[model samples]
Target: MKPTQRLISTLAVVATLGVGLTACGPEDDPYGDGAGSGSGGSSASAQPSKKPAPSDKATDRADGPGDCGTPPKLPAGHKMVEPAVPPSKGSLSAKDAKPVCTPNDWIYHGQGKAKYYLFAQDVKAELSTGPGRTKSVPVGQLWVHAGDCMTNPGAVKAPYTCSGNIYDITLDSEGQINSIKEIWHP
Candidate 1:
């Protein structure tokens, strides 16, 4: 055959093979399981699986805050005054506490005392409403030191000092304070 004719034939054959391969569907693909008929063979498998919601109860333990250890003893001369709102549960496990968008919402929503109590000299101070700076605690936990409590009503600024006891708290999905544990106290 002439060289030009041979080259033309080869080119035609390659084009036909390319089109044939391109036409193959998932059903025709030997590597595919056929579950995603129209989608590319591996693309269907590459899609990410749906992640479970953070608030799903099934992911957490059945027990509530009753399972947490005993809370720290109230400071001497410090009385356990009733909080404006009490926490929903006495305690909660780290797994049960859900990440919340607004930590204050969780802090103010529960049935338990709305604020933590601290005693200085003979006087008692409210942890929530008291004067101090407020900052983000670690994940799964919220903290408010007696010094961290705000005395002023406006924006929280620096010069924070550790005052009374440190109130470490946690919350559930519904923004309820599920657990309260005191870390440090005078």
Candidate 2:
């Protein structure tokens, strides 16, 4: 072929290769498992590094509070009793006779302007009365609001049913009291 034609052909091939390579970056892992390993496999399949249990000295020197960040030990004289389950689902009214109130943390509710108090067996007896900060509020008395459904913990956000007593509790924007409806399993 002519010299000029041959030179032009060679330049064309080189230009194509240069453009191809330029389009690829370090992020382009053609054979990688998306982890940049380029091995077409996952590192998660490998056994995790084993960790040693806390030593006695390490446990004692633990810095956090609450029995070394453990559950509180019951008093020696205190007896372990199973948590109680409500007899039924639906609002518990004052006409249902006196409901048991075990002192603990409490959450308050308000409707437009008026406020109300709620008491429960398991829920903390005291909760913040206003937004962001939780002030110590008392559980004066409570009458389960109608239409609330009992639900299991960590389930639906509101209006559900389960074999336990759950409440459709509402709080204001500032964490003020709103309304509460006791939901219990039938």
Candidate 3:
């Protein structure tokens, strides 16, 4: 093969690898067994995680705020929407009358087996919201325009890092994460 051809081929391979690796940042902890905060991390996995105990305090408030009695009034006429509580796939269950909001530091296990896994801050954390910069623009509310899913966390840019950020996850009937909203706290 010509030298130019070989050089171009090498560049193409490097570019491809760069993109794949950049998706999940090297510094980003991406693997965990549904337990402690930022315990372990790696790339997205295909298998299900071993169920943890049902008494995890971090995941105690599996449902979102105002779940039991009054639901929080979502701005832009967005009300808390989700399916009725279904039997949990793992230790987490959506046991509520309204939508299922799992409040914990769940790592978003990337899409797999046609299901999105939200383990205890250890699967692969995928924010329905796209990327954004960090700046105190408004209150806890995430400023999202119409036809937009959501913006990245105020402090952190990447969503898969999943370490200290707390989130309210909406699970479907089959116990799969549908949408995720990161809660800002002081």
Candidate 4:
């Protein structure tokens, strides 16, 4: 072969070898275990990337406040003070009628933690998305303050203060929702 052709053949062989070696390099391992080098002292699967789980931190809030203890429930006369509304329809002010609570394309108001209330022009049990009276809210029972014009329900914590709104809801002795009043707050 000519000198130039011989040189070209040698260069081609070197290039092919380099590419083969690179293809078998550390990053190419499909299993990602880095097992081929035999330095596999620690398997990738064995060690997690993030820190270990916290013993003190709570992942959920169902337990209660202060990261401990049984959480507070609705106070005594809670139901009697306010009435329960179907969660799907949301709450309303005293001046507002129950039918006003349901609208065909209603807006959502924030309810207790992780919950939302839908206010519409009318709510029909036949037309609602959930059971006759229940929704998959953060908590059971929809509560509305009697006086507050704001439609949102308060958070689930104790002493659920009203923000110029009277939740029309009242609680029973068992802390379950009992009634919703048609009367407005004075």
Best by TM-score: 4
Q: Which whole-number lDDT from 0 to 100 does residue 27 have in model 3? A: 22
lDDT by residue (1-186, candidate 2, tens digit) is: 699999999999999999898845322434321232121111101111221123332342242211111112222332111112222232222211111111111111111222223234433222222222222232322222121222233543333222223233444344433443332322
Off by over 4 Å in 4: 31-33, 40-186
Give one digit per residue, the lDDT tens place, for model 1 in 1-186: 699999999999999999898855532434433233221111001111222132432231122311111112333332222123222223222221221112011111122323433222221112322233243333122222321232321323333333323344433444444334332221
Ranking by TM-score: 4, 3, 1, 2
Off by over 4 Å in 2: 26-186
RMSD of model 2 against the true structure: 19.3
TM-score of 2: 0.17
Cand. 4 Cα-lDDT: 0.30
Q: What lDDT tens digits, residue by residue, belong to model 4 across residues 13-80?
A: 99999988887743354443433432111100011122212332232122222111111233355321
Q: What is the C-alpha lDDT of each candidate?
A: 0.30, 0.28, 0.32, 0.30
What global local distance difference test value does model 2 have?
A: 0.28
User: Over the stretch 1-186, how does candidate 3's per-residue lDDT look in tens digits?
Assistant: 699999999999999999887745312324312333321221110112333333432242354321111112333422122212221333322222132222222222212122224334222222323223132222112223101222333444433332223334555555555444433222
Comparing 3 and 4 on lDDT, the stronger one: 3
